[model samples]
Target: MGDTTIAPPPTAQRRAGVWQAVLLLAGSCMPVLGSVLITPILPQLSEHFGDTPGAEVLVPMIVAIPALMIALFAPFAGQIVDRLGRKTLLVVAMFAYAIVGTAPAWLEALPAILLSRVLVGVCEAAIMTVCTTLIVDYFHEERRRNRYLGLQTVVTTLAATAFIAIGGALGVGGWHTPFWVYAVSILIGALMVISLWEPTAAEAGEPEARDRPAKVRIPWARIGVPLLVTLFGGFTFYVIVLEVSYLVVGTGVAADDTATIGGVAAIASLATAIGGLSFAKLSKLGHGVLLPLAFGLQAVGMLVIWIVPGLPGIGVGAVIASFGSGVLLPSLLTWVVAAAHFADRGRVTGWWTSAFFLGQFLTPILVAVLAAGLGALPAAVGVVGIVALLVGAAVGFALRKASAAVAA
Candidate 1:
């Protein structure tokens, strides 16, 4: 038996470590950079393009187009990742992202700059899909995968806060300066080239993969519930992030009091990061316990904002909701990906990415609609919180019934 045994190929035996995790985590932040880095400079962009037709609407689109693109294109990027392979698409997307991301620095026309943003979003789609797919591929162990997914949320949440600050600072030099920040991807892409390798089929636990069919149909039935939940999770997650500043002002803090506003926003962001970090430990409680807790915390936080009144209420509520969102994100992700096979992992991830970002893109619109109907923004948020509470209750009940059936 010893004489008959054979060794796996070096590629199959290759294992990911801290270096790979670091690069992939950093790569995961590219979409966040695309989304928020330019937000602080939006007024500058508006001033620069003030004369252009529809500049008011178009200027904000510069900040928004990438998310729309991610929602629209991530599934396609996943198809490419699954069929073509992950590393190469990721590398190409990163390089492309740098080029387009920096194009706004020199472009004169508003339309041209917007076009660059659209392309930037296209690159972001590939970057996000590939980065997430790779993270799962590299880490197969349950605990390790869950930890990094939680870290993905923490890193990106923290990065969004940092980018906002950096963008504001760089805008002092003109909007063009922040455009240069896009070039950071070039450096990351270069490092990925040196440090990362494609995971082979054997590494994906399919040692006999050569004999399997080229296409593996995605297990949509298993993933559908999680994806639907993720869409709502995405919307709820951004509710605090997007509305906190407005909530602060509504609390009677002057909008121009950037110091007070930024401080509150930063605290909320830190709470989100803490929640994400905590998920690695808390995930062992399983989704049944975690999801309800995450959503309940969000409900409580938002309800506090609705009922408690003023900045103290808003601040406390935002931090609680943000933390719940942090927990919710990774929980949804792990739930969706837990059943994915290597063959369809890319597509599954792509759909999840699409569902989540689509929710993000819709958050503002939905909140606005709710606000109009309710007569106040906080009321709208409160309504959403109520919905979240109900959803969490439903999920907990369903899980309990399923568990009881299995036990029987």
Candidate 2:
């Protein structure tokens, strides 16, 4: 029989350059901004609203509400992206993000500020979903896509640290001062307006078979395991990021010693960034290798924290586990979105985002509960590490078996 492979139409040859990638990456940081920029000012916020009812609870929600919103609304944003298009939603969301994210700066009432945070979260959902979706769309080639995805992790991790510093510096002016940082999005949104374009189905390289009238469905069977794994990955990923300060303080370091705590945390963050930078080169090993390796490193790191006493163990273990987390994120992302077609990419990215943030949102609560049950936070962390080890082993064995079967 004659060969029947068909090349993509010339219209599908749209190529994205460094500028577009840069813009999309900057856009991706919108959610990170929503997440971390207000953290340093949480105490200030609590102090200001100290007299308000439930201020204790509601004050913290200003930092947390956005992640919750992303978890709940990212899928909806994905639907809109898939139906309405990526660029418009992203552009609109970025502009809206600047508006809502800065509202707390001028708002007088606590309830009003919280409401503004909710809107910030909503915009974040759209921004993150669209940014990720567009990245995959713009760079469909495996090597290029993997590199950028890995860079996404690196950029965001480093951005978190920078935002924290900025927030602290701005917080010197009062809780409201840090909020002005949100206006940075306005500049990014404007740049995106000029630099980004709506990728056509052809440009997304839609396959000939997918052109039929058949209703497009999410490839849940293909993505279910990855998404589930991502949920757990998300939890493990944030453990060091969220709890390292407490872990340091637990080791007899003063809570007020921001230098020691911040230094340890910064080292861990650097490790994570290093791991993310390495992934593009290592991704050739495939998920079967990378995922298990990442999880195992995390397990070992956490185990070190549980076993080794004092600051040495905490610092070393945090760095190791954070590096693993850095590698783990992009791996999970590429695993989910790799085989997705143009029609379904937005929803796939959305669900993956939702799964991850949901896991992040649950991390503190689950760790708290585990701490209560175990009587020590390190013990709880060790327990989670053990689970990660078991998961890694299972994934490795399953992938090996599947490979063997395919060979046979």
Q: How close is candidate 1 to the true structure, as a TM-score?
A: 0.96
lDDT of 2: 0.91
Could you tell me the C-alpha RMSD of candidate 2 in Å?
3.4
Q: Which digits, one per residue and each the tens of the lDDT, describe model 1 over residues 126-216? A: 9988888888888878888889999999999999999999999998998888999999999999999998888877776667876778898
The number of the candidate with the highest lDDT is 2
Error of 2 at 282 (Å): 1.1
Give Cα-based local distance difference scores for all models. Answer: 0.90, 0.91
Model 2: per-residue Cα lDDT over 216-310, one tens digit each: 78889888988899899999999989999999999999999999999999999999999999999999998889999999999999999999999
Model 1, residue 394: distance off in Å is: 1.8
The parts of candidate 2 lying over 4 Å away from their true place are 1-12, 207-210
